[model samples]
Target: MRFYQATRFLFPGSLRLRMLALCSVGTHIPLLALAGWQLATGRADWPSLGLVIGATLVGTLFTLLCIDALLAPVRIATRAVAALEREQTAALTAVRDGDLLAELVVGVNRATEATKVRIATLDDAAHRDPLTGLLNRRGFLTRTEAARDGTVALIDLDRFKAVNDQFGHDAGDAILQDFAAYLARGVRRSDCVARWGGEEFAVFFPETEEGEAAGILHRIVRRMGAGLIDRPDGSPVTCSGGVVALDGETIGQAMTRADAALYAAKRAGRNQLRVSDAHIRLD
Candidate 1:
């Protein structure tokens, strides 16, 4: 057994070859020992020895071929497992029925699917706002890191504190959610809207210039001022916004200018849009 174990490296790195080598070694070792004993006792003739050796060799060859045939399914299953480990486009659908390999394939597929679902759930929770179903501040910042040129808008609800005081917290929350939905529907799919904080929302329009953004903001302001959003007591709910063009500035700098413009709009009246003229330094 020790000699057989040491000679394993003589065979190729294949399951079939290793099995054949082991079968041949086990059959020939005992025959060689018996022939040695017969020669020492002077009972082994050349013809008889040659015959025995030839018959044993033939039997060993036949047994090795049978072993190779029996292990062919195992070799296929092993290759499938290797492909999966390498992330190659291989499917284990051809596993034999009621076999251990079939059970392994099913288990592996289920685990992969469950892992994908878990990752998606975690990602959604991390990026989405719980109340408004929009992107939160963190998610927005992450997305805007790649933006080169566009428009940034900061919006604030007019007299939101009065609504919460007169109606209730629930009503205030409902108003925020409704405004978020309205903003989402008002913009293109390429735009991003985020809840920047309490009573404040931020929007990013990618690849849009100042004039285009101003026109869009004006339309939104007019639509909002026409009493489209209502309070519990049938009062009109309005919002003030500040729009600024992205001119080689970071998102943080653009947001600062927009916020300043938003407050300026709030001071000017209460339901209008203000465009910022802050010259962005191209750093």
Candidate 2:
């Protein structure tokens, strides 16, 4: 293997080939001169000259053939790499002559498979919320096209700041997690939930009417808010939510309306569900 790899410099298609050709001529020239001198002195026969020429031609042909065989795998590898760049995986079948190159091709295929799996796993992790184990903003939007003709609800925890300030951020995180679990329990399998950042969560009800979506969000707000969070002091925590209807607008715009309704709910009084309507204010 080491010899084959090292002799890559001896192959054609390189500046080294011209240098090698020059060296071959230089070495063979002196030998031919000596042979001619022996022939002139009547010490060498014509048959011996023929034998030398034949030997040189056979040796050169064999060397060039071996080098060409070695480069075949490299060419195959180059094409395989191009395929891998275009797609995620490509297999090299050109090196199937039961040689070391075949082993290398098999290894490369296995490595490419592993790389593809690892990339897919990373993509999934990147789109998922680490804390709530729900879809993050990017993931939600990626799947939003399939979720059309649906209503999206923005669920913001009412007085979430009080929880963070009073019970500590850790406790606030725990409260949000608990709320997320409760909300999950309230939603159907057709619905998708996403952590839209901070204490705000968005829910998508696919192919659902506005009234049906409102009832579902109402349940989520009531059940999730009524659920208690056990603090370090062994006390309970509560939350509220704002719901909004969604239509042809982008998810961000729909979320803004929901957030506005959430703020309005907080302003009206904590622990209540406020649904956004055209008559409502930003409060």
Please name the candidate that would achieve the greatest TM-score relative to the true structure.
1
Q: Rate the local accuracy (lDDT) of all candidates.
A: 0.79, 0.67
Candidate 1 C-alpha lDDT tens digits along 1-283: 4664455465423435666667778888978898899999989878877887899889988998887678677767655655555443544654433343343555467557656777889888798899999998888988897787999998899999999999999999999999999988888899999999998999999999876776776777777788878999988889888889887989888999998888888777778888866422111
Error of 1 at 160 (Å): 0.9
- In model 1, what lDDT does residue 195 have? 93
Candidate 1 yields a Cα-based lDDT of 0.79
- With candidate 1 superimposed using the best TM-score fit, by how many Å does residue 192's alpha carbon deviate from the native? 1.3
Can you give the lDDT of residue 181 in candidate 2?
83
Deviation from native of the Cα of residue 65 in model 2, angstroms: 7.7
